[model samples]
Target chain A: MSGASRQPNGSHAGGVPHDDDGVPGPGEMGGIPRGPEAPAPRPPVIHALRDAGLAALVAAGLFVPLVGLRTDVGPAGGGLILRTRWADVAILVALVFTGRLAMNLWSAFRPAKRPRTALRAAQLTRIGTFVAPLFLGFAVLMPLLPWTTRYGLDLGVLVLTYVMLGWGLNIVVGLAGLLDLGYVAFYAVGAYTYALLSTTYGLSFWICLPLAGIFAAFAGVLLGFPVLRLRGDYLAIVTLAFGEIIRVVLLNWVSLTGGPNGISGIPRPSFFGLSFSAGGEPGSFADFFGLEPSPTHRAVFLYYLILVLALLTNWVTIRLRRQPLGRAWEALREDEIACRALGINVTNTKLTAFAIGAMFGGFAGAFFATRQAFVSPESFTFIESAIILAIVVLGGLGSQLGVAIAALVLIGGFEAFRDFEEYRMLVFGAAMVVIMVWRPRGLVSTRRPSVALGERKAISGDLVGEGHG
Target chain B: MSAPILPARNAPILQVRELLMRFGGLTAVNRVSFDAMAGDITAVIGPNGAGKTTVFNLITGFYKPSGGEIVLNGPGGPKPLHATVGHRIAQAGVARTFQNIRLFPGMTVLENLLVAQHNTLQAATFFGIGAAFGLGRYRQAEREAVALARRWLEATRLLDRADDPAGALPYGAQRRLEIARAMCTNPVLLCLDEPAAGLNPRESEELAELIQLIRAQGCSILLIEHDMGVVMRISDRVVVLDHGVKIADGTPAEVRADERVIAAYLGEGDEDDVPAAPVEGAA
Candidate 1:
């Protein structure tokens, strides 16, 4: 069977003929000619074995969380309980397969005319599509659900926070082509800024948010001045160092930051005079708003608030990408010398990109502090930067839609696999490797040329030039 | 040269006085001095590595001259133009092209031209922030940029491909497009390096005509070309360089007859050993 599979024409291998050029000449090309066809090349068994070994390793990694869970539960209770969770695994697998299949089918039958309408429809579908899993989790697939409803809502809030962070980072790394490993430092700054201001000065969340963004923008400018001449790897390393410095300062400065323990009891966003807590009065938000007295309301509100912020981020980014400053960033990315020749002040351009990107990060950070009602240095780490960068790369660098899609797949997938606690990170790492191998340029690889001085058009023909200038 | 324009009684529009540019131990341009009169085509010709491009770079501010003054008789008065960077030089009405084309490859042809006029656009008061937000001044700048880009594209006969990436054009078209992009900056002195290099015979003739047309627009052109046909046909004055020194500078006929130029082309002391390539029937 292996030999038959290896043959060029399995049943008629002996009838094939070889030409000097390796391709069949004239009669051989036209019809079956009796001769020795080229010897069928054997499959590389070692390569196949290596691939199988890697796959097994990845599979083995998925059981790590289960092992951890088993140890926690003890030998008597662990085995049977682990067996029951297999149903949840099957449901997740089915959902992922269905999503892939649906995407393929939808793309195949997509309409050609009314392109604008189609684009709008596609966008609406994208926005509304997440409702499916949520509906299934809450209403339909109850047995497959691992956690109680309360923890599920908490997972949703966490995912929303990262989604906002991803969108903010996308502005710097994706649109501006500036590698900012220190982005989380700005986030930490915002959270601490809000935390300190509200706790000491008694400012509300609403007032502190914009103030935090302003402060972060100033910090961005401070960082930008020192690294104006740096580019590529040097710039990345400097920014990484800057992030560490911010974290270290926060840790060492005992008086201002409360040292490593971080500020606590940060204020939550309130609706007018009504608080979310039950003891505020019998006719507080829960009674007057005709809602259940549960912490889920606050979680839901924070989720939607972040959703709005994320939407704003997307809108502002799209607008900014079409503006002159945005074009200047892209020009600087393509060629700094040419950008300078065009009289673009490279220093100002770099600083603006840094400031704007940091401003958005600050907004998200302020929201995060309010949402959690606490802050800490542990929350902002180098791993957070890595995850944000991974989202941008996996989404395809310099593409807004791609970044959003990447965040959904990565952050959403990570959250969805929470029940498989032992295997979750393993699965995430394996997926990243597989993705890199399959699409080295990322999920949506192609990009439009940034400068559209006139109307945009499709680029045709190959880039033909010799020697770099 | 029929009495020059601006400054002194008959001062040249641009005067390079004993300009010297050194890179560490090597001197690229050694006390090279020349004057480009207004409304004339001055050709700088030399063999490979004869420092023709170095002269152009010094004049256009790509490299800072080690010594001597580059004086430009501005609309106000005669002044020593400081050895500034490329963008500042471009703003001072001196534009240049590279020996190898240096266009923004990923930008559209129109964008390439628009970027040339970036400094000229009347931006908003607050460092272009107000304009960037789609304010009135920004809208006008956009309209003007579009119009200017279209005019140059038309001039280059590349209007149909205006939206295409600059790198996608054919070789000759790319060369012409570079000239058009420079012209969009409204430069007083256009320095073209090897404008005829790599062009076919027909394209070379067309390029000569384009240079003549630009000269007709009252813009002084300083061209470095290896093609004798282009230099002899379009140049009102030709300066010959050898070993980083000016060997000859005069009208095409006068420079062609100079024995020093012949020696530079055929090499000294071997003039009898090697037959010189017949100069293209002197245009």
Candidate 2:
């Protein structure tokens, strides 16, 4: 859109697309009120050629220094000398020129996309309905594969952890329409809760897990109080501040959090009081079950633990959508003023959304602490919150299955390209830009009503409110 | 004794006394006062920007009055609506429609109705947790809620499209759905702002019938309308406001004849012959 806007107005002619306000005839667009779908007056094939040529020229100019030339050490002890690689520059320019030309022509000639409607959205979601169960089944059985490696199990646990976090934040951002940039704060709370309890009080992970969620929920309520009246960007800014506040507090609160050094050697969760040691101790998991000793046992157990937790989050979220409170949250998102007229306590609804979302974050945090046996303020940064938010938004806000898939792709994608760590952010950024351009609403953008008296239909994404809150 | 279906007819449902609202230097509604009796349609007729909606806002608790009070005479007796907050006004048995339609557009039509009765289910579900666990009691409450929603959907003629998103409903249907959604809150007083604004004559006639039907159900109607044809025919009583002042309050016929009310309308509408609409058995 920005590129389209930047072009000289008359240059668009008939070939360029405008927003579909009713279709306008071709020649009227240059001067009259223009729509993106205005009919082409002329072929504009010449304009396309000019635009593509110009783009290629710019690409060549940029590539001349960036790719066409390289510097090498001149002799062992001396300065550098220039090496020309015009072949590389020519290939890059040719690719850019053709790519730009193809994109321009495709966009120009393509029929206008159909307006989203409930029936169409329902048809799109039918595909997801079929695919989701198959994906869930695959996830459940993947750990049981005969060639499953310990690294693979750990990666599964990691991806599942993000999936849980994404599901939790979905309640706040997607369902309630509250954009929370501070979700990772709750995760930090849960991790620190387990870390401090297990390291200080010698409490088991089982006991500390619930406490972590409770504490995080408590923190959620605390954050919810002063910001109850804020909405939209104001709400987002406050939540962002809240996230930074938690991180800074942890960084400075030396006596309790150990400052920047971080707490380590946090105890791993036991399998119902059975340790995972290979010492053949009586309480060891292998000893109790009379199985051969292998460290894979602990990894597999951790994988299953997080898997169960993630599934529980998904299940509870699905159930809550049918509940009155959940419906109110959605209503509030659609129109807060209307919610007020309908006699919904906006304060209570927003608070519950925050608290519940934070509780899940806390649960995930405890899992993180137990798995890594380490806790640090550095682990709970704004980046973690951004990544989690990206997953929710990219997954189509409230879509449960979409969130799971997005989490898997994002977290697994990050780990899979570990060899190219330097370019990881670059690839991620490009992917985000491409996703935003292609599908602004998200990958799966249908919203199924929590309860329906008639046959259920998926509401089109355009109808759903991007909650001001 | 066989009971009358209407509850306590002719009792005062809403009373406004010296209702005032000010935005900065402008006094939107100044010293407006009126009473709507139960089982009656009270149409508030006024010129544009004459503070009709300002008065409705004060009564619905959307805006805190600069001065004066609005009261709803609930079954429990007169409760001060002006003192309560927004949702509290609805909880106190007062509900309103926006001048611009404000439905939960993303939700299905049935879901919009269900949201209107949120207070009941919220309590039944123990504020959201019990229902999450599939509690037994909430399921029954939910069934009752759905039944109630279906009844209203049937009333509004939206039953066939219950599963469609509210945003997709035709404009006239959306207006009817807004009224239905408001009634789902079970308010004694329903305040409608310009309910028939964009309706064609046929649709407006249907709206008049719906309003009367609502009145027959024993709920008081407080309406702000620009369509004089619908206003004069359906309202049992009409209160005229011009520039934030009530110029006349009486039966629709009386108010129509009042010279002051006619002058306020700037003689735009011939006040005398609106009643020819819905003439029975006319050839």
Q: Highest TM-score: which candidate? A: 2
How well is each residue in B16-124 modelled by candidate 1, as lDDT tens digits?
A: 8888878899887778888878777899987767889888877776677889888766554555654666666777677777777778676678767766766655343
Q: After superposition, how far is residue B112 of candidate 2 from its true place, in Å?
A: 0.6
Residues A312-390, candidate 2: write the lDDT tens digits: 9888888888888888989989999999999999998999999999999999999999988888999999999999999
lDDT of 2 at A56: 94
Model 2 residue runs over 4 Å out of place are A1-40, A53-96, A108-126, B1-7, B272-283
Model 2 / residue A144 / CA error / Å: 1.5
Which stretch of 10 consecutive residues in model 1 chain A shows the poorest summed lDDT? A1-10
Instruction: Write down the TM-score of model 1's second chain.
Output: 0.88
DockQ of candidates 1 onward, in order? Answer: 0.20, 0.38
lDDT score at residue B200, model 2, on the 0-100 scale: 63
Off by over 4 Å in 1: A1-160, A272-274, A280-292, A419-423, A449-455, A458-469, B1-11, B74-81, B120-128, B131-133, B266-283
Error of 2 at A387 (Å): 0.4
- B154-244, model 2: which lDDT tens digit per residue? 8888887787789977777888999999999888888998888776677788889999888777788999887778887889899999888
Model 1, residue A109: what's the lDDT?
52
- Candidate 1: TM-score? 0.74
lDDT of candidates 1 onward, in order? 0.70, 0.85
